[model samples]
Target: MTDLRELQFYATPEHPCSYLPRRQAKTLFVDPSAELDQCNYSLLSDLGFRRSGPHIYRPHCEGCSACISARIPVNLFRPNRGQRRVLRRNQDLEMRISEPHFSEELYQLYRRYITARHADGDMYPPSPEQFDSFLIRSNHHTRFYQLHHHERLVAVAVMDQLDQGLSAIYTFFEPEMAHRSLGQYAILRQIEITREHNHPFLYLGYWIRGCQKMAYKTNYRPIQLLINGQWVHCGD
Candidate 1:
């Protein structure tokens, strides 16, 4: 295991909170110049850190501690009725995994997802450059999984295959297919994929309490939340 304490971290200046309004947010990131790899990523993730593009970061707010790292202990996760419905709903689609690469098909789906779902957010004006930089270009460990329906791409899930588990970086799906609930379905499939690789956990990134956007993550039972620098069951 890497001794993350010995590594340098750079904290960003205060910025507007993305989840909670009327608040400021700060983040601590692993120094970009550091020798980051799968091993370091695993340790950092275990320590409540997460990756965005190529930079690993975590909430470092001065006066608040609402953003907590969350993960599913895959072995103990049992899909609730809604999740099981998602599984059955997407069962007709084919799942394909590929190394990170940019394509018009994926870009189109991403654009639709952002425009309809996050038009009010920072990534509202999504572009090819941003997509390439954020999802395509990364450490060689990144993988892109696609859900296809009759040979047409419907969703894309970006994940980082770390030493101990898979980190779900991002996921985008056809906005018109909201009835299928592809977002939650993708995570369920990811949990199965991680289990197939013998990985013990599926890092779902930060889950901020009282943030409606993060409420769905709690649907996955037996989740671990980083509290006071230690991993513990959320129910506890």
Candidate 2:
């Protein structure tokens, strides 16, 4: 086990907060050179750290702590009525878990998703290089959950299988299928996958209160939030 104290971390200067407008945010990142094996990655996750590409980091903003690390205790999670509807809505789609790899098909879908849904976000002008760096660059534990309807691809959820649980790295779906609520369906399916694998939790990255984009995370009942270095159960 790598000692937490032995690992080095660096904090970035305050930048514009991605989730909140007009707010500055700082991030504490694990040393880029650190060898982040599954054991230490799990440890860092327990301490509220999240992985992005090859980097592991957690929010370190001063005076503002809106980004709360959220996870669903799989054994304790019970899908609400709305979530059940999402499951039913996406029942026609088949989910396949596969090793991470790059394909032009996937990239094209990602490009359309970003162009339609996130034109105002940093990932607006999605390119092959950006897609490769953000999602295709994979570690040993990375997996891609591909959702399809017969022959048509609809969604892809990028996940990392950790020692303790699975972390939802990123998910993008067909923007035109808004009626299907594919984003929520992806998370719902991931929770089931975690339970099937006998994992304890499914990390959902950071959930910021009052951020409409993040509010969907709280719908998963009995979520645990890392606060003050401890995990606290909410909405039991």
Candidate 3:
């Protein structure tokens, strides 16, 4: 058996929960520059963390079922009719997955995406420093995928590589490119990447049954839920 490891997670005092209505929220994060191996990721994923930059975090709360870890079986995955259309729509775009780096254009598009999609939201305008600290500071198995539409940055996705799967940290896209359904396209691309790499799963973090912001992830069929510390297939 692989030996367990330890890491520190820091968080705020308390704040209103984003996913669960009327509930408080808090986050405890470890330094992205810290050592994190495949075994560490396996343990953390089991603990309910998705991934962000190099940090692993789950919803730490007094009481809440609003957050659950989710993943897609890459081997059995298939692009539905709609997903195919999204792929077709983004055929002209180019994707590059590499070490995380902040760019002005990427930041500008991210700001627009936040303002247009979540203006009234808590993380409306993430400062440049915050964005850097959130994504580029990681020293572990973290990567950023940038999608370019004919040399113009259109979308970006931060992810973590684990022994069994890939975890999508967060994604942002140009608001004007909404018609392309970049979000779904990104997830599909990740599935393809995961499959090519022989990874069995694509961790999507959570699937809140009623949250519109999170429900889109569930559209990917043949997902597995980590319930009671066991992987439960939603279809079978």
- How well does model 3 score by local distance difference test? 0.79
**Candidates by lDDT, descending order:** 2, 1, 3
Worst 10 residues of 3 by lDDT: 1-10
Candidate 3 wrongly placed segments (more than 4 Å): 1-14, 26-35
- Model 1, 1-236: lDDT tens digits are 34667788889999999999999999998887777768888888898888777788888998899998899989999898888989998899998989988888889999999999999888989999999888887863988999999999999999998888899999999999989999999999999999999999999998988998899898898899999988898652
Instruction: Show where candidate 2 strays beyond 4 Å.
Output: none
CA lDDT scores, all candidates in order: 0.89, 0.90, 0.79
Q: State how far residue 116 of model 3 sits from its true place (Å).
A: 1.3
Weakest ten-residue segment in model 2 by summed lDDT: 131-140
* lDDT tens digits by residue: candidate 3, 87-134: 998999998878878888877877788889987777767778768877
Assess candidate 1 and give its lDDT.
0.89
lDDT of 2 by residue, 1-236 (tens): 56789988999998999899999999999988877689889888899998887778899999988899999999998888988999998899998888877888899889999999889998879999898888877654999999999988899999998899999999999999999999999999999999999999999999998999899899888999998889999987
For candidate 3, list the clashing residue pairs, or say none.
10-29, 32-139
Q: Give lDDT: candidate 1, residue 48.
A: 86
Query: Which scores higher on lDDT, 1 or 2?
Result: 2
Q: Please give the lDDT score for candidate 2.
A: 0.90
Question: Each candidate's TM vs. the true structure?
Answer: 0.96, 0.97, 0.89
